[model samples]
Target: MKVLLTYTSMTGRNEKIANYLADYLKEKGADVDLEEIIDTDAFGLTDYDAVIVESYTYHDGEVPDEAQDFYEDLADVDLERTKFAVLGSSSKKHIHFGRAVDYFTMQLNSSNGEQVSDSVKIDQDPDEDDFKRVRDLGDRVLKSLK
Candidate 1:
């Protein structure tokens, strides 16, 4: 499976989790690509069978700036053939926790992208359980391909 992991991180928490998820997927024998949302291009997105969007929630339910363009570019894709999952990293203490994931999932669905299932949300101080959810998200995405 060709998978793309695109992420935007401000405090490095999201970056670390994105990398961890990428490594886990790679270990499972899936072809994975990791791109910082800011560096991603439209062409790169077409190459992946699945795209996992990772983002941090900012004030008032906003997605970070670095990923806004990446999210916007998603509208241009012919998403009928793609499978995707949204992984959100946020602090539960934040008022808008997991809101970015919700928005991205909605946007992707509106653009005709197939959602594997619900989103996976990791909290500020994620433990092993949080990591398991990430793995589960990957598993569900792969499952959809079959």
Candidate 2:
């Protein structure tokens, strides 16, 4: 399967998670395209069979500035046949932890994408348990495709 994994990270935590997930998916025999969400204009969701977006929650659970354009562009895109999953990182101190994942889930649904798995949220860096959860998420996405 072709899988696109994109992320926006401020302190590199989300990027690490994205890379880990990419490796996990690749081990499961998927063709993975891992990217940093710096240029949303060049991203085309239709080209991939499945997509996973990883982001770190900005202030007050908002999308990072770098990814905002991509978030907005989702409304104009057609994702009828693509499956999506969202992963987000945030500080546990925040009241709205992992809000970016929720926002992205809404956008994915509005864009007609099939959400294959529940969203994953991690604090700062991922631990062993977090990695396991991420792996299970990949498995779920793969299973959904079949």
Pick the lDDT winner. 2
Q: Report how far off residue 28 is in candidate 2 (Å).
A: 0.9
Candidate 1 colliding pairs, count: 0
TM-scores, all models, native as reference: 0.93, 0.95
Best by TM-score: 2
Candidate 2 positional error at 71, Å: 0.3
Candidate 2 deviant stretches above 4 angstroms: 41-43
Provide the lowest-lDDT 10-residue window in model 2: 35-44
| RMSD in angstroms between candidate 2 and the native structure over all alpha carbons | 1.2
